[model samples]
Target: FAKFANVNDATSHWPTGEEVFTHLPGTHAHAPLIYVALMTFILIISSVTMVLAVEAGHRMDKKAVIKWMAWTVVGGLIFLGSQVWEWSTFIAGYDGDISTWADNGTLSHSPYGGQWVMGVDAHGHEVKQMVTYGPTLYANFFFFITGFHGFHVFTGVLFNFLVLRNVIRGVYHKRGHYEMVEKVGLYWHFVDLVWVFVFTFFYLV
Candidate 1:
């Protein structure tokens, strides 16, 4: 009888996590899932394209390798430009309605300045109404990780360009090896690995 009563008390009108979060201010939910998804898919597909390029290089199909590398460069540029646009949207907020929130025990908030991030401050409590703030820890991690990956892509394009240059000049043929493509493929794979984690942590969930 006692256990039954306690269980009933605990279950009666209990708010779900969403219900609790519904009252929070900074949960403004300003994400363009479409754009983000496109960018993610593009990067993933480009990784596959790069692998195909590397395989072509391995098989001594210089023409096929060059074609794929050219495509990879274009795809990489597209992804980078998309990210720049995404960042601009985030920074400006949507339709000039930048969200902002402050914790005054009551969760009423405003959207005058962009809600770039929601995170805890020095005392391990959220700085709810961050009107003008740079990268927080989460942003820091995302920037460092993703920015590093972008850097790698940029470098990869440069490396691929050089490889193409050498290939066109019959350098690889003279050397009788495709080690350059093989080595760069390893770096490309690392970029893909980092992106998988970023997509999971940042976008998916």
Candidate 2:
């Protein structure tokens, strides 16, 4: 992972073992995996609530439909909030070594960016190791991909809210079919499915 050079490097054109930095920074205390799991759980619950809303619509139970749809909206909002927090943490990086650097007045930056380390070489001799915080492209990709998905979630929540309002207004009830609920439910489910892929690739992998 650390053997590859940056994509924009103008010097090296191949894996010459000269570049030992990764393209993505390592995880730190700020970005916990449990938070991601919680987000996933909330999204899954929201999807289930959407299903319940659709089912209630099928039975023409206006109150139940409204209730489930409201819960779904709440879940989506919570997930969006969580994503915002995650993005903030990622952007802020880790502060473990910041204080020390500040005290020295040399550099006051997160060590997650890059640093040197003392490690024993193959022959048990101490050596200075060069480490890097990873490529800027990783952050760009993280923001772009997750931000795109977050936009979808936001739109889904907005649509769900509108559908909920229509339900309360008896718009679907008058139509004698809850097809709108089902349609929005499909969109919500698709958003949830896309999140699963995003979570797996971005967080898990």
Which is the leading candidate under TM-score?
Answer: 2
* lDDT (0 to 1) per candidate: 0.58, 0.68
Candidate 1 wrongly placed segments (more than 4 Å): 1-31, 96-138
* Per-prediction tally of clashes: 1, 1
Best candidate, lDDT: 2
**lDDT, candidate 2, residue 91?**
51
Question: Which window of 10 residues has the lowest lDDT sum in candidate 2?
Answer: 14-23
Q: Lowest summed lDDT over 10 consecutive residues: which window, candidate 1?
A: 15-24
Give per-model CA RMSD: 10.6, 8.9
Deviation (Å) of 56 in candidate 1: 1.7
Q: What is the lDDT of residue 167 in candidate 1?
A: 73
Give the clash total for candidate 2: 1
- As a whole number from 0 to 100, the lDDT of residue 5 in candidate 1 is 34
